[model samples]
Target: MSPSELMPIGVFARRCGLTSSALRFYADSGLLPPAEVDPVSGYRFYGAEQLTRATALRQLREIAMPLPGVEAVLAAEAGEASRLVDAHVAKIVGDASAALRKAADVMSSLGGAPALPIAALKGPVLADAVEQVLTATAHDPSLPVLGALRVEADLEAVTLTATDRYRLSTRTLVPSAPPGRTWAGTVSGDDLRTAACHIRRSALVRLEAGPHGIWFRTTGREDRYARLLTEEFPDHRLVLDSLGTVTGRATVSKEPFLRALEEQPGERVELRLSGRAVEVRPAGGRHPGIALPATTTGAPLRVRFELTTLHPAVSTAIGPDVMLDLRGHDQPVTIRSADRGDLTTLAMPVNPSHGPRR
Candidate 1:
């Protein structure tokens, strides 16, 4: 509190990573008032105790936090301060995404290209489908299109599909209004994820395709845009068409099936399908596994899958019951809702392997 112990404005600024003028500005704003003032000479001095707050203020400002936000963050408790910081970062990211989309739209307009109508869909349904199908996407630096969602639309329905080589998921959504014509594009999955929240809140969404991007013009929410990838998406249809006939089939309650998988001790899981039960057990292990009551038909069979590939496919099913169709031991298994076949996932089984001992 003594004048001799106080640091002059220049020294304080140097130590705190702020300019002298910034100190004065914050002082005037009542955020970082100096420890002492030489009234006659109008000199300002700050104490060492103020360094922590000044340093935090500088760091907050570096992130472009507004004055009011900076003030609130500074005054908040530790937990609240952390939450505020996260919220601020989220807003910045959302703003940056929106700005980038707007810039792209502006550039697109300068080219004088017309926006073509793609399709119209129910907001909640489209949102759900996007979330479900996107689970199949993977981050592969070598092939970016694999990280995107392939959207194909026709007069009858619009289909969303994505694949990560190991798993392929697709859902067909009946459009509220038919498309102007048939259309297809691979959209950035990250952009779609960011737009999902807004899409879900609206009653309807009209999709408009431009040269470089697609727009989700919602009925009562802000329009969102997603960039289209130029890289070619994999020919998922080939895999679908080449699928072998199912040799074994089982319909089981989804909740119990998922629970059994959850309690499995290993990364590889084996499913044994017989007369009226599906045994979920760790792969290649002697452990007696959990069995769920199921209605199974066709030949008895056992199939193994990586837990990573199988869990999401079943968890995203629409209803209480899931139907699994198996072609053979090393084939891609088909998973879909027992009653509603609109959404389907094909999960590839890995080679038979031993699971960790219980």
Candidate 2:
């Protein structure tokens, strides 16, 4: 193409709703490079076709996707691109919720007395257990305690619990030694995740808690610490008991089920379970549906759920097959790993009148 066909950086930036400097920065970061560069004047130019990539870059950056993630999305195919963007949005929302809860706890402790010393627990097993329940930690600011991982240890095992009011997860691990006395407290979800990440680098991880703060350390590495959220965790055992008897049950392969859901177009989908197969389609529509084989043993049922809320829980399920424990359309749906009883996720269905659950 001739010089007339190539758009100057300034013109291209204006057309793409971006600043000239931003285009330059994106080019330097390899997110959106210029189509051409003048050897003498250092002027940059872009072809008309480059606008699609430029627009995508701007939109991805606006959503706070990291440069590396943006590059991955830009390199992906159409289907993969949507999946990457969805995952990024979910992470940002989760982090924002945790931050709000942490800020609230900090503000409330301004004039409180010093905290008591917390006992120390060391081992990768404990760290793994804490990480498991962190997935269910509450991200909503309204319920600050649920934003924390409840840590309880006795002589035999360490238990971790987290809930977001909508769902709950509990994990237990056998500890190397039992504390002489029980040690229980709530720690920020963000802090627990950081600890879990660091613990993986060492053979043994040590956890120490005090009235003012909590600390996690691995030999030859920098220790991590944060203020513990003193709020009381709800009686989660009672919540678990209230899950009610399962009225319907189905065990389906995770990969196929997840793929079908991903291919579905909308943010909500209706799940219809028949004798031995489940049909998934866009909520309130008949076309664009897929059926997958399942081991079902209950009455045929139809339920609608927000895909955003249901997808993550299934994506993180432990094994090849996930078991669904259903009560009714209006009730919360319980999902578990068919192989292990340790992991459980509960997702509340979308109320018919209110549309999708936020």
Candidate 3:
């Protein structure tokens, strides 16, 4: 055959039926670079060699392998490349299976029928209530809810919580949870994790609490039943405070907090409460305290929050404002949420009780 025509980016996009944006993305990702770029104009040009790579990349992406992963496969040695491709194929198969399972459940719900494995839940309406609370309440995997529930509506709401000692779970039937009187539940401290495992296929999910467990059931399956747990659960509320009472809301620079702890672990980050601003100063004031550039509203209470407890939560805080509610001295500070549900209500003892006594 005669030599194939060398294609430019525009020609490659047209022939491949892809978009210019996609071509640029591939080029930037190290998967395919243009043959040349006009020095002054900076216009990208492509050669035929890249077409092969582009075609293969499109196929790999179709198989659900991400761009970075594709690069790994391409760069890997012969034997290693084979193993990587095998792993990629296995992931694709597993992902497809999961997708099918979800589709089937959706169809079943749409048909107004109970999803399969309905027998997995067998208990009482009380179980449904526990499922509601344990499902709604903030959860920490370090603490899990070992309970079940039954419902009697097309929707319900539940709160789930655990205390290494006991678990408390409750549900609300305000037309939010499942229609039936029963469902299973789990608890976790991670939202991304909760979405993956729990909260599968259903509408109206208010992540008012921590993520831990999940309950899967068909929509409009009201006659459903649930198993019950007749055990006492520790009162997390008593151990914790309400979210509204949180008056302290300060915006601190996250970078310095990391540096302070790195300089000296176990040292407290002193937060001096004045009017509406709390200066986050390092212990002993060796490193000058950094006044939060932002604003806040709360009681003028001077407190020292542990760097260990504060750092991790602040690092993972959803947005700019790290709202801290320190109402009770010994109570855990409530980490305010500006999103769907409460992000974290961390129980922190009053910082002053353990004074700076070295």
Candidate 2 whole-model C-alpha lDDT, 0 to 1: 0.78
**Which scores higher on TM-score, 1 or 3?**
1
Error of 3 at 281 (Å): 2.8
Rank candidates by TM-score, best first: 1, 2, 3
Model 2 over residues 150-254: C-alpha lDDT tens digits? Answer: 877676666778887656777666544554456887888876675576667666655565565566656898666656786778888887788767899889999
Q: Estimate the TM-score of every prediction.
A: 0.76, 0.63, 0.39
TM-score: model 2 vs. ground truth: 0.63
Scored by lDDT, the top model is 1
| Runs in model 3 lying further than 4 Å from the true structure | 1-179, 182-233, 240-267, 338-341, 353-358
**Candidate 2 residue 213 C-alpha distance from true site, Å:** 3.1
Q: Which stretches of candidate 1 lie over 4 Å from their true place?
A: 1-85, 108-111, 353-358
203 Cα displacement, candidate 2 (Å):
2.3
lDDT of 1 by residue, 171-268 (tens): 99998877779999999999999999999998889999988888999765678999999999999999999999988889999999999999999888
For TM-score, candidate 2 versus 3, the one ahead is 2
TM-score of 1: 0.76
